[model samples]
Target: MILNSSLLVSIEKHFCGNELLNGEMYMEGIKHYLIDMDGVILQGTKLIPGAAEFIQRLRTKGASFLILTNNSRYILRDLQVRLHDLGLEVPQEAIFTSALATAQFLHTQRPGGKAYVLGEAGLTTALHDIGYILTDQKPEYVVLGETTTYSFERITRAIRFVMAGARFITTNPDVTGPGEGGIVPATGAVAALISAATGAKPYFIGKPNPLMMRTALRTLDAHSEDSVIIGDRMDTDIVSGIESGLQTILVLTGVTTREQVERFPYRPTWIHKSVADIEVEG
Candidate 1:
């Protein structure tokens, strides 16, 4: 059955009321939350103030949540360790990445196609885990994700392969990601650069793409009315949550600032400066 647009708008307006009233959310009850990593939970290497405690509170109240990220350079296990180190108790299955979504998409569609991957161990491992073979030896597809070892040679090779009729795929289109040394180039930048060179557009698998969100909902077995998606970016997080039929909360700790939000065409259901400012009462 098709969902109603007016219902979505009403849900959005209700959530936005929390932002208008400043930091407090007094809804009926929320059962699940999909949270972002870099900006909403932590800025760079440090945890966002009170995020760990907020998560602990959610857990104490028996709420279901997942950590969703557009970053594809790290796998679920990697993110689990990182969040644990930051004092947030997150399970491996509760972590979802664009890489995982891309891998899932590839598994259902291509099955066992040979792929030329221009990414780090994360993307390679994801492809391998999904039974896709990795090869630079005339592959059927060119996969782009974040790689610290990105070289001009690698980009040139990817472009050459795509130009030779290889299909292209990407994890997400985030131009940059927040890191310890300020912002660094993300997988999307590399994809754009290669797309420009090869004259072939790549299909994105993360944020704003419903695959990951659908997977998350299935994993959690939760409905849209009982859940909310929180993140720092608008194009990725806000758009994804809105499209996925969930309430949206934009935290201003990482990429998009308050002024930038005003300039954007879309708006989140709620906006907060940091997770520290969000207090959910039982």
Candidate 2:
């Protein structure tokens, strides 16, 4: 279902205001695609239309890709199961998470370090897998991640640890996330509270940081000039990709709408309706 080059140009002219793009990805096609999860492929536990097809297209072209998600609540296996139940066959290894990135960064900085964790199994297990000890007894770091079960007891403990000279780190800086009822405070919100109490700012490890993108890109052995990042958020996904020197595609199927694009000072290399509108040829 690849659209003709002329049709692609027309869409770009209307949305991008340029018939030709200004990146290495123009006409050459993408070698690797760093795709977002919640908004691009899935929407509230359901697979978006054309998600599976887009994945299949990539596989058929022998392209490299990764499912990059900022949600540190679930591990790779958990994500695979969720996507599997939703009719997508994404492999566990193909998923890159903020928890994993944070763990990797910490491991590289201080091997076998200890931390006071505030998150779910995803974050805990990532630290565990890296051979890092998790404890609240005057640890070396105070790591915060996405957790639905936020308790005042834990928040106070995190603040105390940070105040006691433990370095503060967070998974991402997203202040809000979609909850069952509506928008609810996420890791960023909780991190702010801890920061306010301890007078300590946290080092964020996820999108818009560019470190996460570089790590993920290195994992795939993909070069930035020939890669593309597709996402729904203008703040995290698009900015991260642009900063990391990769072409960015802002898809409308997720959190960001077409109108919201004008608000951001930066623009993605391309804007498509969805993954369905993007096709690659080898």
Candidate 3:
């Protein structure tokens, strides 16, 4: 949604408890919110407490927000369907995935470039949407993204491709992720294997690399100073938000615990038990 001055003022009055009536004063109350999906909104297939209501509140208040995720297994439509099943009605346009970010990064770095992609529908679909040709025939890049099953042949091919002078790229640096059975190796783990074999480090295009955050902000037409990022992980979401110059809120309903937060060298702008405890109205 397009945020105008009047809308900003109204939101400020509702949340900030200030009726300064000036656009500048209202703008200080957060024009956009970048929210993480996995930990902060859902744990595995279940929705976190107050996640649906919090999203609804944002929609009802006409606040601009994006559900950002690093998992590149499912496309936007698939993710929307999953959220819908959990009773969370999020618009497809408001969802941003690391695969999409990687695709955007590639498009800017080398428009219409070809790559040997080792990923699922999310990554392949994003690359296809951006007109990136996926092939193993002397590709410019060997792009790696998350998948439930990492095939030995695919990893071998990716290693060979990288050794053949193809630059390596990955969606995110998450070494492990939650699975129905338990924790499973993710993109970062596979990337490490390829790196070990090929001695080529993959450029991570997802969280902790401010590029993804900046891209999401650009998509929402948001200013970093007037935006807030809500996430559960300090390593990925929080650090990315901070590096992107956005205010960060760390929620403890996911991988990060209250005790673990103290171990980080940097701190978020705000801390909460979960999305349930966050107050839009100050």
Candidate 4:
């Protein structure tokens, strides 16, 4: 559905209001919400203030939403446990990760394909679940994903595979991500290293790519016009939302700050100080 100018204006006015909510403000047009996980919900293992409450509010109102993440380190169960440990209740079905998105994309591209994977349980499990064979033996694709410690030997093997004509695929384009000890090299950084070595670039299948957002919307049975994307990054989340034809909400609690946002050519539909400032109730 196309979001007309009047509807966009109404959304802007609703966010600008100081009140928590007016009657049916959220239920009026927005039925689905796509939320980012890392900086928007939690920074590393620490929960951002009001993150749990915001999710609870969605659950309480029976609203449709999904916690989307580009991190391909852990599987859905791991993420669900982590959120539970942080006092947030998110079902596995309500969470979507880049690992899952990549796997889905690959499954559609090449069914039962062989891959040489450099990732953790998340990436491996997703591919395995989709009937992909994880091997270094003339793999159809050399899949790069996030890992705590990237192995030089494995990267060497990946380069060799790419040189041998295997396709290259990476989970996301995030060079660094927040970890327990500040920032760490993510999938994109590792993919860059491999690309530099092999002179072959991997197809990134995560945020900033509208494919990821489109798949998430399909999973949620949501339409862009009635859905909202809440994220902390302008490059990935906001751009992807815009490309996917969804209203975007930029939160200052993540990688992109207000000043950084100003540098971007386009703007989000709304900007909030944090998730705490957003009222999902109506």
Candidate 5:
């Protein structure tokens, strides 16, 4: 049965136990998904309700997907371990990190190049796998990524390298990340400090930078018209998906709220409580 716009809001419907939700939501004809990991899937270290179910729904419908994250601290294996510890099972190839995108970007620009890095296993491993050498001796680029331990000594070296004409690059533009107590300094925060000292701005290669989105789509072998992105933050995930020509779904389970969406000029195609509320038609 067809319903008018007024009736869609006044009456609720359900199919196969999934509620037909509101808020510009539409999942029909979506053959692929690009989902944000931190907010849309798991908040902190715990799995968000319905996250696994959503993945299962995608798999059941023979859809392709990739879990996207801006955090560059851990490699794919590390992320797999963390997700497994949280009672969630995700394939290693199904996860994509900003570090990987950064490495890919550098590989294309200057293959087999040297770089001075300030990150954990994730960033360094990605750079290494891309045939890029990690060095501090007159490197071509000074790469920055998220690290649990922020060292003044390493940051100082990065600043000096940038001052010496080494191009600056960062994994993501997030200034802060979720910590036990509150928000903590991230790659963007340190990038800001380095910029202040050297007067050189670094290129960001994560969400909100359609570059990463396009790279991910290529990895999935999927087209934007047939893909959908589910994220919580409007500035990064939503904006990047919109700019990349993919459908965007904003979940309220993370930073952005229902009322806060009105503040942005651009709007997500859909807004829901969480991934669980989303209906993926089979």
Candidate 6:
């Protein structure tokens, strides 16, 4: 009703709920959702008890969601195959990874810089798609992600380049990521080892940095208040969601245990055992 500053202050003393200080109103609604892949959706080789059914219900309700993961070992297609095999419907476009986020950051930071990659085809493909010139010969940057083919030689080369003043960047800072067998060293651990040797810390561009979350949000075109992020890791997923101004829901079906949540610095808005326990009120 076009209330002025003075009137707004006056109304605030008595206004609440559906009415704001200026007679404006706001209500939280769920429009888009971002979910963590490994723990929240599926754990190891099995889908979480109710994750698939929950997603189906969300789809039927016309809510859009993207499966966001900090695991950069697999590309979008790889993840899609895994999800499909689990009987969950997930499109490649609905998958976002730290590899993609790192590539995007590099594209903006140094468009044509030559990068030395220390990861699998996922990170390489992501960099190539973003128009970066990847090379091992006198690279201008050392891009690190999770790699199963890690070796002392690759580490030595990356350190050499970084020591020679090449920019260093990592997809995420997760020391160990959840795997089919158990926790395994992620890109963060590898990045740290390199940084320790070269004394050059890599800029992290994945979860908890807000870059990946923002990119996912842009892809969905979802308003901050109208969205929620569900994940298992408090350090990456939950923290990133909170930082990006989205409601955070921590599911106990993944890495972070129930007791761990209380000790976490950033507390989620809600906690559940799995998607099965959640009721999408929006």
Model 2 weakest lDDT span, ten residues long: 10-19
Q: In model 4, which runs have C-alpha deviations exceeding 4 angstroms?
A: 1-27
lDDT of 6 by residue, 173-245 (tens): 8888666677787788888898888888888988889888888888888876678889988888887776777
List CA RMSD, all candidates: 3.1, 6.6, 7.1, 4.5, 7.1, 6.3
* Candidate 4 minimal-lDDT segment of 10 residues: 16-25
* Higher-ranked by lDDT: 3 or 5: 5
Task: Give per-residue CA lDDT, model 3, range 82-152, as digits (tens).
Answer: 99999899889999999999999999999999999999999999999999999979999999999987889
How many residue pairs clash per model?
Answer: 0, 0, 0, 0, 0, 0
Q: What order do you get sorting by lDDT, best first?
A: 2, 5, 4, 3, 1, 6
Name the regions of candidate 3 deviating beyond 4 angstroms.
1-28
Q: Per-residue alpha-carbon lDDT of model 4 for 179-224, expressed as tens digits?
A: 6757788888888898898899889999999899999999999888
Candidate 2 lDDT over residue span 1-282, tens digit each: 897765555344334632355422352656998999989998887899999999999999999999999999998999999999999998898999999999999999999999999999999999999999999788999999999999999999999999999999999999999999899999999999998998999999999899999999988999887788899999999888877777788899888998999898878888888888787878
- TM-scores for candidates 1 onward, in order: 0.87, 0.91, 0.89, 0.89, 0.91, 0.86
| Candidate 4 residue pairs in backbone clash | none
Report model 2's TM-score to 2 decimal places: 0.91
Candidate 1: tens digits of C-alpha lDDT, residues 1-282: 875986666555645665675755554467888988878897777788989888887788788888888778887778888888978877897787778888888988889889999887778888999899999999999998886778999899999999999999998888876656677888878888988887888999888786778777777898877788889888888877777777778888877998898787667777788877766546
State the TM-score for model 6.
0.86
Q: What is the C-alpha lDDT of each candidate?
A: 0.81, 0.88, 0.86, 0.87, 0.88, 0.80
Model 4 score (lDDT): 0.87
**Candidate 5: stretches off by over 4 Å:** 1-24
For 138-178, candidate 5 gives per-residue lDDT tens digits of 99999999998889999999999999999999999999899
Cα error of candidate 6 at position 79, Å: 1.2
Better of 1 and 6 by lDDT: 1
